[model samples]
Target: MSHSQPDTISAALARGRLGISSVVSFVIAAAAPLTVVAGGATTGYAVTGVTGIPLAYLVVAVVLALFAVGYVAMSRRIINAGAFYTYVSRGLGRPAGAGAAMVALLAYNAMQIGLYGGAGAVLAQFLDGYGVDAPWWVWALVAWAVVAVLGVLRIDLNGRVLAVVLIAECVVALVFDAVMVSHPADGGVSFDTLAPSHVFAAGIGAALVTAITGFVGFEGTVVFSEETRDPRRTIAWATYIALAVTGLLYGFSAWAMSVATGPDRIVEAARADGTDLIFTLVSPHLTDSVITVARVLFITSLFAALLSFHHTVARYLFALGRERVLPPAFGRTSRRTGAPKIGSLVQSGLAAAVLIAYALAEADPIVHLFFWVTVTGGLGVLILMTLTSVAVVGFFARIVHAEGLWRSTIAPNVAAVALGGILAITLGEFDTLLGVAPDSPLRWAFPASYGVAGLLGIVWALILRATRPHVYDAIGLGADRDTTALRTPDLVRHPA
Candidate 1:
């Protein structure tokens, strides 16, 4: 009875209650299939034309798979909530990890807060359709409130909510794909869409960049590793599964959409119809009621994405806090649900501030708030992933593990180079991606913010090293522990 008491107390404080399925749901929710289809696919068509969009997804998938080979290997050794920050630290050093952590905090928060602009815009439109008109920011605040509530609850509860939304999203997409496939437009189902030469005919670089952005949230599998049932196996399996599912689903849907609209006309249709192109094609077959259902599902999909990202940002804060890199208050979890209560509240505060500022400035939600911020966030993630791949190679090169040559060295290097090239192209064509002028400061400003954040992170680490050596020792290596030693006031904060 005495031994069991400690176990119960530990369980209540450190909540690692998530499993493989729950982890998968969190990642998929972050990807937000409906948003990808509605936004990414439409943009891909407008930028690269039809034949190349599917191919772009396939290529990015292969590169990320190579990246994951080393990523999963490191996850087994260093289990922490910091994700890229932890992996980079394991491979590089604590300062570099701290830099990555700053990047991650900025990237994840940018991504999450950016989604509010989209959710508000979409929800406002959905409400408008039902004769309930309101300002976009008002709708955004509604979602903010709901997500804030969910973020403070148990993670398993969030998982269940995401699972239901994810299922509805998948169902609607599959049904749409089936309808499109069964009634392929004039040219009929053509394998021509899958041809490499055809896929790159319009523009290879643009298509590849857009496609990679669609897979943004897959790397987040490791963020939940501490909460998962089995960190090593769960992280590895979830990473692979999330990547495969996202790539296949995205590739298949783009192809079906092209076929539904006729390959030759897809670009024109996308340019003309935007996100409504696919809905228009499928609307002819499905009942009128299905349209309303899909629109509702679309709103829920954005909400799920918001909640998933909120949890991700909160966890990052929680991990950093536990290391004394940030305030230790963020490290506190609820005894009842094991949720990072303080971290969740912190994230919510940030989101509210951003939303309020944007509203005050009267910024255009879609253009200024959503696309501008999300595109920046996506670029930051790419940079982090590229660095992580390099870190992986560096880590495995020294450490003698049984994982073999391919997993340790070769794959990581190749992924890093490929990703580096993509990053260069993305920068070169920044104006085109942002739909802005060649000299737009917004183009340079967003990417520059990341560099500033990284420099700040490095400085902060050096300060910690000089002032508090003990706290500096545990930067990216922070994880929950029961030991009384090292449990300083600056370190782990236990639940009361």
Candidate 2:
């Protein structure tokens, strides 16, 4: 407990700070339920012209729940902030782990920065109603500053902020759903959109991918395992709870919107009103003040997601740094708050740079920055989940464990095939998801960047193996600096 040993304190996250509810809040806020329903779902309807969005949400939820069965099972044995990176390394090999690490950093950074575009645009429009005009980047910078400050504070403090915003966002969204359902269009309460047949239709790939993006943040439950109290139970419960809540909310709300607009006209309304479709639906039924409040919550919903993703990206960097995959400086933390100080600042700096670059080019915030970038980030997460599912089987194959066949072998194998198929479908529909021409290079370019990152990481891991063997040996062993020897043993492990 001596304050003199700064290295010991700085290398570790603040332990025993987060509980089940706080962890759930962090995961769900990252999903940004309100933003996904208002922005993502509407975009799905407009861009893909798919009415089966509700079914897509439920489908992805089940797929991820299967993914989580093995995911949380692994979390009990290995506690690391690197999450996917560590799991892949321990289960696969060091080189693959390194590749997964870089992919994760790139993906999470894309996701965190992409939110600035949506948050900035929404905030700017909100202020425009008050006759205070400013560019979207200006509002984005303001949000950037706030998230940057909070990123360096205690992990639980960030969780508390997210919990409050997330609760209000969900409440408002539910109210809107109730109002919309009660005032159905002429067809009156049709459940056609929720049908399974619609899931296999022509544009179903795009709709499924869009729904997958909405659940992108649920896997982040393991990203916080290092800081949670009783991570074994806490992480498992939080993962399931977050998935169930977001999935149910998204599916119910999407169905309600269809009920309000009528199944046939839902796509038309989405195209006309865009993200404003939800508010427009409720406007005739509710007062102006309530609508205004919902709009403000929309902005806050984006902000909450921004903070959550920032934390996720920062922790990934911290894990890499702690393992010496990156410079040791990236691993350092603030002793007082136990936050990943250097990693947090680095992510914030990267986000600011991207914002400035986009602003300089006068890019469309909603289209180019938010929609394209976030969809690509979702693609990265999809890739990681597929890889991690495979890794789960590998990891269990090498060990003696008490976990049942369902948790260790059967579920992971099924999830791997399911997610792998989804990944293929998503890649095929990337153009549709981006609302671009099939011949457009942007579709290939965005997905290819992840390949480049993975390749570079693999090369770097090889370099480390030759030039710096110790660091390479510790590639996925975050905070457990002395466990390198145990890694080679056929060990019987127990839950933490």
Candidate 3:
């Protein structure tokens, strides 16, 4: 006789935790500092001639805003912690959802792990000024320990800390931009910079790539869904607002940096200042004290970003655990807080391992390391997103509203097409972007990561098929409970 087993989701998830306001703050905070961390390459500054980089950021902000047309629409309909998971499962099936989860795990982790290179490099560079000389990995290990402590804290605590950093950075960057704009070397603010002619000039491609760097952590809104008071409204709002805010902020700074140095000054500025171009541009406008503040904020900005991604990876692991995609271990939550302890532990472990490997490799943790990791990670996420866009169109068809084909079907379809094209162009230009060899290690790692992730999905599905069909059937589904009897958990919480 066949029997039905209790669902892992129902068993795992607990309620009465997160609110909408905090969730909004979390997502916006996460997306803002990506540029300071990732856009260190001269290409971003070179392409747009500094002034045009902000324009490029605005362009992507507009592009992403358009994509959010469908993204928000879908978010309203699908309310699960496992954003990609549910989208794929509803649109495709268990197998596809399973695949997306694997890909997302690898992609997010790669992004997080990539930060070690960035953080270590910045720390090393900053420390080198004071004549402290240890390997970059030494700093990364210290950073990793910090991250591990962060992983164990309350989500709200993380939000409060990030908000302070995000706001401070925004103020610093904007103030610098204002100063640069007010004091242009060449007569006045050039109309040519904002004009379409300058934006698409021969060198604009590199600047556009840098501008794109400002938007990497945009999708982090979904991770806070389970905690949010109203997942749909908050996520929907955060998605658009964060993109716009970060775009404008980065856009203003990039433009200002160009203006401060005058026409054809970005390259020279970079040469004179090295990787400190962004901060250096602002130094003349502020006191030496404020310059120090800006530099410190840059590091803090990365920490905020790390805290945000830490939440994201934990949620992915939690959802996978709750669904039994990987194992029940990930599904287990704290008896007090309802946060997924087991899943958080697993995610933390993986992050630690990746950090250790880079330390062991003794890699030069500069913008180059940051560049390769993000490009690969970005490509990985793009693959997941393309799959999700397809899934959104399909899943919404059967279960969601049947109103306009544009929101659910046509718009997402368009986003998918556009993203695919961008991905193709980016891959073609990877060497150009990095100034590396054709057969460089990154070229292979980028595709290989995607391939490995997809293969892991196949392997996972096979394991589920052989030993855990009940768990397998629950793909893309976040919290589940014992429908037959929830009196126990309630009594435990209340403790009558």
Q: Which candidate is the best by lDDT?
A: 2
Candidate 1 wrong stretches, greater than 4 Å? 1-13, 47-51, 191-193, 198-203, 480-496
> Pairing residues by index, what is the TM-score of model 1?
0.91
Per residue, candidate 1 scores C-alpha lDDT tens digits across 1-496 of 1364323122222446788889989998998888777766776677444456877788888899999998998888767888998777767777888899999999989889998998998888878878998999999999999999988787898899899999899888888888888898884697556677954353566577777777888999998988888899999999999999888888888888888888777888888876667788889898989988998888888899899999999888888877889987776677667877888898999999999999999998866777668767888899899999998887776555788888888989999999998888778767667767879987688788989999898888889989998777777656634444335431222110
What does candidate 3's lDDT look like per residue over 1-496, in tens digits?
A: 0135333222444443455556656776666453452244343553223445556667767766756777677777556678776677667776777778888887778677776677777777778878999777778778777877777566677777777777787777677678778988786886445666655455454455555555767776776766776777788877777777777776666666667777577667755665577666666767988877777777776667666777788878888776777676676666545566666667668877876776677665654466567546666776777777777777666552654787878878887887666666556656555556767876566667677777778678767877977666566555533332223331122111
Query: Candidate 2 residues 1-496, lDDT tens each?
Result: 3456465357789999999999999999999999999988997888888889999999999999999999999998888899999999888888998999889999999888998999999899889989999999999999999999999999998899899999999999999999999999974789989998986787777888889889989999999998988999999999999999999999999999999999999999999998899999999999999999999999999999999999999999999988888987788889899999999999999999999999999999988898888878888998999999999998888887899999999999999999999888888888888889999998799999999999999999999999999888777777676756355443223111
Put the candidates in TM-score order, highest first: 2, 1, 3
What TM-score would every model get versus the actual structure? 0.91, 0.96, 0.86
Please report how far candidate 1 places residue 127 from its true position, in Å.
Answer: 1.6
Error of 3 at 103 (Å): 1.7
Question: lDDT score of model 3?
Answer: 0.66
Residue 335 in model 1: shift from native, Å? 2.0
Looking at model 1, the pairs that clash are none
Residue 385, candidate 1: C-alpha displacement in angstroms: 0.8
